[model samples]
Target: MTLPRIAIDAMGGDEGVRTIVAGVALARRRHEGLRFILFGDEAQIQDALGHHPNLSRAAEIVHTDRVVAATDKPSQAIRQSRGSSMGLAIQAVKNGDAMAAVSAGNTGALMAMAKLALRTLPGIDRPALAAFLPTLGDNDVVMLDLGANTECDARNLVQFAIMGAAYARVVLDLETPRVRLLNIGTEELKGTDEIRDAAAFLRTASGLPLRFDGFIEGDRIGSGDADVIVSEGFAGNIALKTAEGTARFVTDVLRRAFTSSLRSKAGFLLSKPALHLLKVHLDPNNHNGAVFLGLNGMVVKSHGGADEKGIANAVHVAARLVEADLAARIAGDMARVGPILSEEMIAK
Candidate 1:
């Protein structure tokens, strides 16, 4: 089988081309048949690749000097970044030259460029940012609309559930992902009208692979009550940030406690092996990629400050999405969903 090419915006990350090139090399080890189309400054990219000759066998560079700044607003990036490396990489997906595009660029800028260049898929009004978060359960939970759209209506929430489930199928390898609406309470008559409406649709909607498990409260999110958590961006963003902050806080407190005294130091040595396992599970590098779902083409966003390992994980995510045919799965399910539910929503 032939390898699919991935387009990468090599200039956008905080660490620059060296990290991007090295990341690709690392990803190559995981995915044997993957190829690359790298976009960035020619001289700098070449310099970065010099340290990783193994990358050259599967990579090709498309040099462009117009780099999108981390500070650029989405509007500004859409207008001025059309000729930049980020723009070219996105364009590669639009032109079908690459299976997907991966970037560690400005989140706002990448979203703007991707939306403008690739547009949303059919039956999708807005593209959502979806990622898998490590959960207490045996599997990760899929959450969506993370900082993508600040507010979404009933239809939008329902759409998010569908797309989020599609994502879980790929990333989590779930045969049938359970979908839940984020609510203040799990009771039948709680939360906003939008949440209720989405729940109603999911419960009644037919011909889709959705496993509607009713409403799940915020507290239950980490408990793995649902495989896919659907919320508008405002709440989703807050949940994501809060989880991250809490994780860091616990880590800091643990470090301070472990070194507080000689007794604690001895205990720390005894617990070092278990702590190492915990640390590996908590590291963001293991889950570095967040996908933009419902886009016309595939795009994976890496954390801006991600190192080579993180970038490689992000690249691998793009490759996996391509292999799973994420876009086609979403598009197919969407076709079944629209006709079944749109009329009911219109009647309401």
Candidate 2:
């Protein structure tokens, strides 16, 4: 199968060119016909490519020493994006130079640049940041608006639901993804007016390729009860951080307990296999890519501190989304429900 080339911000990650190059090389080894356009310092990228002959043969370099600093705000970053690796990588997507773009850079800056360059799909008011979260169910759950818009109206939440469900369908390979709104309670009447109104809209809207399971409390986020969980950015961001923190806390506690004494050490040795599986499930690297949904083009964000394995996962994510034609899928879904959204907006 012929895959679309991916544009990467080689100088974006915390580890800079070396880690990004190594990760791209790893992804190339794992997936055949994966081409890359590395945006960074030409000499540095060339030096890194020397170590990976396979990648060297399949990759091209677009030199640029300019970078978006971690500390740079979105406002400032947008002004200087044209010459930065992060900006150019996203630009490649808008310019049709690449099918998708991947960056391990400033989240705010990346979002700003991508929005400015790619714009949102016709029916979407704004793009939401969506990512896969490990779940106890057979498939990972998709959550969105992790930090894109702090406050959202009922219309925004409804759009997020559609976008999130479309993403879940592509990534999880489900025909009808079950979706829920993040709320304080699962009761019929709960959350703010926006949540209730959004639920009402989903309940009445027809022909959507999703199953609306109503409001899902924060505590049940990982219960796998729903395939897609939609929320405003403020709450969504807090929920994401809390889940990550809780995972780390659990791992730390287990490590301490396992080394407390000889008895515990013996128990740990006996449970090594189970523990290994648990570790793999909890590792952030396994779920590293956060995609910007509702955008006219595809752009994925890799955690700044992600290692080669994590970065590779991000690249693979971009590849899968491109292969699935995520943008078109979303556009189609939005078009299907455009009339419903318009009526809802008019009613408000």
Task: Give the Cα error of residue 58 in candidate 1, in Å.
Answer: 0.7
lDDT of 1: 0.89
The candidate that achieves the highest lDDT relative to the unseen native structure: 2
lDDT per residue as tens, model 1, 1-348: 667899999998898789988998899888878899999998988898888878888889998989999999999998987989999999999999999999999998899889988988887889999888888998889988889899899999988998998888777888789999888988988998888888888888777677999988778888978899999999998998788778778989999999999999999999999999888777777878899999989999998888999999999999999888899989987887877667877877
Predictions in order: lDDT: 0.89, 0.92
TM for every model, in the order presented, reads 0.97, 0.97
Candidate 1: regions farther than 4 A off: none
Over 1-348, each residue of candidate 2 has an lDDT whose tens digit, in order, gives 655799999999798788999998988877776799999899999999999999999999999989999999999999876789999999899999899999999999999999999999998999999999988988999999899899999999999999999998888999999999999998979889999989988988877789998999888889989999999999999999899999999989999999999999999999999999998998888999999999999999999999999999999999889888999999998998887789776786
Which regions of candidate 2 are displaced past 4 Å?
Answer: 1-3
